[model samples]
Target chain A: MTRAVTIIGLLLTVIIGAGTYWVSHEVERLEKRYAGIQSEILAEQESIHVLQAEWSYLNNPERIERLSQEYLSLAQIDTLQMASIDDLPENADQHLYRLDKFGEAVAFLPVPRTRPGDLMPDEAAEAMIIDAPSVANAGGNQ
Target chain B: MSFMRFSYWLRGDRPELRPEQRERLAIETARNRIFITGAMFFVGFTWISYGLLDASVLRQGNEPAVASGTDTRELKTERADIVDRNGILLATDLPTNSLYADARVVKDPVESADLLLTALPDLDRDTLIRHLSSRKAFVWLRRNLTPEQQYQVNSLGIPGLNFQREERRVYPHGRLFAHTLGFTDIDNNGIAGVEREFDNELRINNGPLQLSLDTRVQYALEEEVQKAMETYSAAGAAGLVMDVYTGEVIGMTSLPDFDPHRPGQAPADARFNRTTLGVYEMGSVFKLFNTAIALETGSANLNSVFDATEPLRIARFSIRDYHAENRWLTVPEILVHSSNIGSARMAMAFGGETQQKYLKKLGMLEKPEIELPEVGGPLLPHPWREINTMTISYGHGIAVTPLQVVNGISTIVNGGIRRPSTIVKQDGAPAGERVFSRKTSDLMRRLMRLVVTDGSGKKAEVAGYFLGGKTGTSEKLVNGRYVKNARMSTFVAAFPMQDPKYVVLVTLDEPKGTKETYGFATAGWVSAPAVGKVVTRIAPLLGIEPANAKAPEIEQALQIELRKGERKLASF
Candidate 1:
C-alpha cells in the first residue's frame, strides 16, 4: 500500500507538469498572435492617416473649382433657378413619368434597352406594329 | 547517524526498548520534518503572490514614461489638431524624418555632400559640406523632409547620415486659412493667430479643436475681397461675415495673406491681421450706431428732422455732409443719404455723454473679444469732448478694428442682443446682453432697409435677398491730417433685413477710382457692390431661401411713409 501511494503521487506530479507545459506553450503562441494583430492595427492606422491627408489635399475647394472649370460645364446655381416645394405641380401623378409605360410606348424606338428579352406579350405586339413601317422600307430598298 | 549518537551519548540516555516504542519515535521525527517543509512552501508561494498583486494593482497609477529618447524630447509632445466647423482639416501634425550627420562616421565628406546636394538642391552645398566635415558628434542637416526625399537620401547608403523622426505643423489649406489659424514656428510652437491663443489647451487636450469658421464661406469672402482689391487697386482689403445672433465669425479675410508653411518669407504687412489687429476710422458705417442710439435713447425718432442746410461747426472741427442735402433732413434720410452734417446734429441732440454710453454699450469702447491673440484696442479720443463725439458719430475721431464694427452691427441687427464675437463654435445660441429694446432694433432694421432700397446703398441691393447697409467714405488720417484723395471706403450690411441673420462688413483702404465707377471711389461705388456679391453667393450656401420681393410681409416690414413734400426730396 505504501509503494502504491508513492507511485500515484509521482504520476500526479508528472501529469500536472505536462499540463502546465502545454498551457504555457499555448499561451506563448496566442501572445505572439496578439502582438501580430496589434502591429497590424498600428500599420493600418498609419495608412489611414496618410490617406485622410491625401484625400483632403485632393478635395481642396480651389483645386476642385479649377478642375470643374477646366473639365466640367457646370455653373454656379442661380437664385432664380431655386424654387420651394410649394411651387411644384399640384398633381404628382401627372408630373411623375411611369418608366414602364413609357418604355412600352417607345419599344420600337432605336435606343438601347436593358433586358430586351423580358418584354410582355402586349409590348411585343406594339413593338411589331411600330417596326412594320421601317421593315417595309428596308424590303423596298432591297 | 554519528551526530545523533553523540547527542544521545552526551545526554547519557541509553536504554533498552521494545519495537513499538522505536516506531513511535520514528513517526514523531517524520511528522516534524513534513510540517517544516509545508511551512517553507507556503511562505514562498505567499511571497510570490504578494509580489504579483503589488506589481499589477499597487503600481497601476504610475504614469508611463513619456521621454523615450534624448533626441525626441521636443517632437514627442503631440499637439491637438485644428479643424473648421465642417471638420475639414486646417492644421495637423505630420511625422517626418529630419536628416542628421555624424561627422566622425562619415568616410568621404566630399562625395556625401555631392550626393546629398543632388537629392536636396535647395540646400546650400557649402553649408552642408561644412556641417558634414566638422568633427561634431551630431549635426542637423535638414528638418521635416518629405518621405520621397528621405528615401532618396537613404538610397545613397552613406554611413554618417542618419534620420530623426520629427513632427511638422502642416497647414493643408496654406494661405487660405493663414491669418485665422496662424502658423507655428520651426519647433512646432504656436507663434501667432488662434494657434497662439489656444496653445495650452491644444497641447494638453488629445481631441481636435473645432473653430466656428466655414471654409466655403471663407473662400467666397476671400475671393470677393481679392477681386475688389485688384479692381480698385487698393492697398489692402478686409472682409468679415458674422452670425448676428450668436456673434460667431463665420468667415474673416484680410489680404494680402501669406502661406503659413513659410511665414518667415512673407512681408510684415502680409502677416498683419487687419480684421482684428488694424484699427481704422471706419467712416460712415458708424452712423448705423448713431441712428440706432438716437432712436434707442428717445433723443430722436424716425420722423425727427435734423437741420443740415449748413455744415455743423463744433469748436474748430466742422462736420460736413459727403453728399450734401442742403435742407432739413429726417432721421431715415440722414442714414439713406449718409449725411455727416445730419448725423452730427443727431449726436449733439443726444449729447456727448449719451453717445459715449451708447458706443460703450455697443462694445466699441474696448478691444473686440475674439479668439485671436492679435487684437487691436479701439483708439478712443483722449479728452472725450463735444467735437470728438460729433466726429466719432460719423466715424472720424474714434478708430476700431473691422471685427468690432461687424460685432457692433451684429448686435443692433440681431434684435439688440450683444454677444461677444467668437471664432470657436458654441453649443447653442449664446445668451447675450440686451443693449437696445426690440422695438428700437426693429426700427433700425427698417431704416437700414430703406438705405438699400432708395438711398446711397442702392448699389448693394440684390434682386431677391433684402440687404440693408450703411456706407462710410472717410479720408484716411495721414500725419495728423486727413488725406482728401486717400479715402478708406467701408460698407457694413445685414441681409434678409426683415429678420437679419448675418452681418457682413467690407472695407477698402485707399481704393482708387475706376472708369466703371464714373470716378467715384466712395463706399457706395466700391465696397457696397462687393458686399452685394458676397451676400448673394453665401446666402444660398447657408440654405437661406430667396423670398419674393413683393411678398406682403416683407413689404409691410420695410415700407416707409413719406411726409408732405418729402417724396420730392427722397429722389436724391
Candidate 2:
C-alpha cells in the first residue's frame, strides 16, 4: 500500500512540472506577439503622418483651381443665383413666377426637393414614421 | 536520532541471531528504510520551494522590449502644422532622416564620398570627405534627406553611414502663404510670421494651428493682384480683405511674394511684406477718416460747405486738389471730388488736437496690430502741427502701413467701433470701444457711396453691389520733391454699402498710364477697376447675397443730400 501511494505521488509531481513548463512557454509566445503588435501600430502611425502631408500637397488650392479651369465646365456660383427657400416667393399654386430687377418675367418649374437636413426635427420624425409603416406592410404580406 | 542510528548500523561487536534478536533486526531494517524515504521527501520539497521562490521573487523574467528603431522615433512631429480657417494645410512638418557619418567606423572615405555624390549631387565633396575622415564619433554629412534620397543612401550600405531621425517644415502651397505662415530654420525653429508668433506652443502642441485667413480667398486675391500688377506695370501691389464687424483679416497678399520653402533663394524685394512692413502715404484714402471725424466732431455736416475755388495756401506750401473743382463744395462733395483744399479746411475746422485724437483712436498712429514680426510703425510727424494735420487730412505728410488703413476703415464702417485686426481666427467679433457715434458712421457710408456714383470713383461701381469707395492718386516723393508721373494709385472700397460688411483696399505703387485707362494712371483708372473686380468675385465666395442696387430701401439708405437738402447727389 505504501509503495502504491508513493508511486502515485511521484506521477502527480511529474505531471504538474510538465503543465507549469507549458504555461511559461505559452506566456513567452504571447509576450512576443504583444511586442509585434506594438511595433505594427507605430509603423501605421508613421505612414499616416506621411500620407497626411501628401494629401495636402495634392489638394493644393492653386492646382485645383487650374485643374478645374482646364477640365470642369462648372463656373463659380453667382450670389444672384442663390436664395434661401424661405426667401423664395410664396406661390399658393406652387408654380414658378418670379420677376428680376429688370421687371422681366423668368419662369422655370420649381422642383420640389425633400432634403433631410432641411427638415425640422418634428417633420423628420414624421417622415420616419411614415417610412416604417410601408416597410411593415411589406413584411406583413411576406 | 540520525547520529545514533548511524552508529548502531556500524555496531562495534557482531551479535548472533536469537528469535527475539532476529525480530529486532527486521524492525530495525524497516525503520531505516522509512527514514531514507522521509529524507528523499524533504529534499524534493526543498527543491520545489527554492524553484518557486526563484521564479516569483528572486529572479524576474526579462520582458521583451519594443525593439529600438526609427519607427519609435518617427511617431511624433517636432513642430505642429498650420492650417487655414477651413482646415486646409498651409504648413506642416514631415519626418526625414539626416545623414551623419560615424567617422570612427568609416573604412574608405573617398569611395563612400564618391558614391554619396552620385545620389546627392548638392553636397560638396571636399566637405563630405573631411567629415567622413574625422576621428570623432559623429559628423553630419547632409541634412533633410528626401525619402527617395534616403532610400538611395540606405541601399548603398556603406559602413559608418547612418541616418539621424529629424523633421523638415514644408509649405506645400509654395509662395501662397509666404508672408503669413513664414518659414522655419534647419533646426525646425520658427523664423517669422505666425510660425514665430506661436513657436513655443507649436513645439509642444500636437494639433495643427488654425489661422483666420481663408486659403481660397487668399488665392483669389493673390491671382487678381498679380494680374493687375502685370497689367498696370506697377512697381508692386498690396491688398487685403477684412470683415467689417469682426476685424478678422480674411485674405491679404503683397505682390512679389516669395516661396516660404526656399526663402533663402528669393530676392529681398520678394521677401518684403509690403502690406504690414512697408509704410507709405496712403493718399486720399485718409479722407474717409476725415469725413467721419468731421461728422463725429459735429464740425461739418453733409450740407456744410468748404471752398475748393483755389488751392489752400499754407507757409511755403500749397495744397491743391488733384481734380480742380474750382467751386464751393458740400462735405459729401469734398469726399466725392477728393478735394484737398476742402479737406484741409475741414481739418482746420476740427483743429490738430481733434485730428490726432481721432487717428489715435483708429490705431493709425501706432505700429500695425498684427501677428507678424515684419511690421513697421506709422511715421507720424514729430510735432502735432496744423500743417501736419492738414496734409494728413488728404492722406499725405504722415505715413502708415496698409494694415492700419484696412483696420481703420473697418472701424469706421463697423458702427464706429474700433477692434484690433487679428490674423488668428475668432469664433465671434471681439468687443470694441466706441470711437464715433453710429450716426456718423451711417453718414460716412452714404457720402462714400456718393463718391462711387457721382465722383472720381465711378469706375468702381458694381451695378447690384452699391459699391462705395474713394480714389487716391498721390505723387511719389523723389529727391525731396513729389514727382507727378510716378504715382501710387490706391482705392479703398466697402461693398453693399447700406450696411457695409467688408472693406477691400488695393494699392499700386508707381503705376504707369495704360492705353485702356486713356493714358491716366490715377487711382480711378488703375486701382478702382481692380477693386471692383475683386469685390465682384469675392462677394459670392463670401456668401453675400446680391440685392438690387436700385431697391427702395437700399436707395434710401445710401441717399445723401447736397446744398442744404434742396437737391440730391445724382449718379450719371
> Judged by DockQ cut-offs, is candidate 2 incorrect, acceptable, medium or high?
incorrect
Q: Best DockQ goes to which candidate? A: 2
How do the residues B148-188 of candidate 2 rate in per-residue lDDT, one tens digit apiece? 99999999889999999887898878888888888888888
Per-chain TM-score of chain A in candidate 1 equals 0.57
Best-fitting candidate, scored by lDDT: 1
DockQ of each: 0.07, 0.11
| Shift of residue B254 alpha carbon in model 2, Å | 1.5
lDDT (C-alpha) at residue B554 in model 2: 76
CAPRI grade of model 1? incorrect
Off by over 4 Å in 1: A1-8, A92-142, B1-77, B562-572
lDDT of 1 by residue, A1-142 (tens): 9999999999999998999999999999987876676667766766776666677677678888899999999997766777777755567555344446546432232322222112346744764542112544334322
* TM-score, cand. 2: 0.78
Model 1: per-residue lDDT, tens digit, B332-381? 88887788998888998999999988789888999899999999999899
